[model samples]
Target: MYDSFRRDGVWPEFDRVDRQLLRAAKVDVAQVAAQIPPDLMATDGPRGVPPRGHDRMRLTVAGIACCEGGREDLDLFFHALRWMAQHEARHYPEPGKTSVKVTRAMLAKALRIPARDAVRLRRLSVLLRDERWGSVGSWRSTDDQDWSVNVGRDVRYFRRVRSTDDFIAATTAWLEPVTVATPAADLPGAASPQSPAEHGSYVDERVFDLVRQSDGARWDCTKLLALLRELDDNYRAGNAYAAHALLRAVMDHIPPLFGETTFAPVANNHPWGKTDGRYMKRLVHFRDQADDVMHRQISRTPCVLTMEDMPARAAVNRFLLGCVSKLA
Candidate 1:
């Protein structure tokens, strides 16, 4: 049986006994069927069994047993079956009764194996078929053709039985791991406000931290970070208009605690405090330019923000960071 399995390179179809066992264990047969390789399964019409060649089958009955129960359970199952195969006369002991009625204690004694936990042994027992004499016993005795027919029928039933809701339920249970948020301080290859290498650039890592620390009711820091990340991407892609719009969005989303309704108030309240009015004046001018472009307002000259205006962008980022600091 082991040699045939190794040579065939495809897992043999589960027999009546296997299906009954799986059902008794409350295993999701459909889920198990879904995992089976497409080519391994039998299809209808002229294409009988597909030639497997030399490719080794990946799954085994032992693997299925492991999925349903743990490794110890599989070991118990294999050991019990081996015992049954070895000691036929001890249990049956009669010619008329072809079926072996081997109890757990009898099987354990035959193999000289240690007694297993009752619950686990009960689950393993399902693998043994219960029926009239010759018709029931070890899977080894079952005809391959019979096993294939049973397997094919069950696969079809599972495919047909499963609904859209079943799929949704399975997917919901099999959820992807939640991603842990990365600290902006740990972000590499990017210039942050605290970094000395680029003092003039506007990348405030603290903004991310502030947003994360804030109570969700007060601010949607996640949305803020997403916008900031997109703004950075747009700037790198040379979409200055989009970058400016994203900056305007950032300004708009500032928490009410900052006491700033518009970009002017934040920019004017800079520590330089109107002493350097150029930053505030340039910010207002850029805001108006972005608004005009977005609203499709006609201008005498084509008023567009571009990469050349990065200095003003950096200054605005500094002012925004100042607003974020108030929340801290």
Candidate 2:
């Protein structure tokens, strides 16, 4: 994001101001600044709060609704997901990073449940009421102002969901690792996930299934390749996570169960033929070698060359892009 203040010819670069003029400016500056509302200030203040202090601190239902913009359940899941994601981001100690985009299907497979159930479970736990202490440390004594208003009493709150243990378990496991371990440097892929037995289709939260999964059949490789030319997109990692809601699935529809040419390390190999359109062959070969550690050949895989078991940083964004850009 472009900072409003970071534009050209803005603030002075030097800090060599004389003390006398600085003192006079401070008082005048205070008076001038006070004319604006406290919300304009960047951080939590003597009498106000900023959005960046802690997880779930500055979040509002309005902000969540605007950003995620899905069914009540997916909206809630996204709200919770973004909150937890932002919290994890703060302790990351780096600017840009790559994190795996494990699908609900993959998660369901690990958790041993149905995919529909996995998605339902994910949608159910939209609000972590117990986890939220207070908004901005100001206690809202009234239930109307409480953040958990929609948690227990809402009717459309994934009506039949008892407890989202499976979804919670899957995500909890997926996110617990700072880095993955393997026999041969483990190339930092996704964690050992939990799953379900059956796979269920997804519901379009915004338009009552107007955008169905079956819609993917409308485009072939030629059409999808043409679509990519009309658009190019990028999403920043972890901070806002807003862009993910709009663009994540656009790519998801194009990629298969586990094949993305841009992300699966087909081009970055020794004499690997590119025109073959067989990235899955390379992935299966490398992933299989890594899984079978008899010869320690997993380390030789191009994708895991300098990373951990899954190459989280090296491949995630490309995978996301490939999902958006169908093979063409």
Quote each prediction's TM-score: 0.34, 0.21
Q: Residue-wise lDDT of candidate 2 within 243-326, one digit each (tens)?
A: 222223233344442354332343333233353334434443444444343234445555322112322322333433333333
TM-score of 1: 0.34
Which candidate leads in TM-score? 1
Go through the candidates in order and give the C-alpha RMSD of each one to the true structure: 23.1, 21.4
Q: After superposition, how far is residue 157 of candidate 2 from its true place, in Å?
A: 19
- TM-score of predicted structure 2: 0.21
Instruction: Give the lowest summed-lDDT range of ten residues in model 2.
Output: 1-10
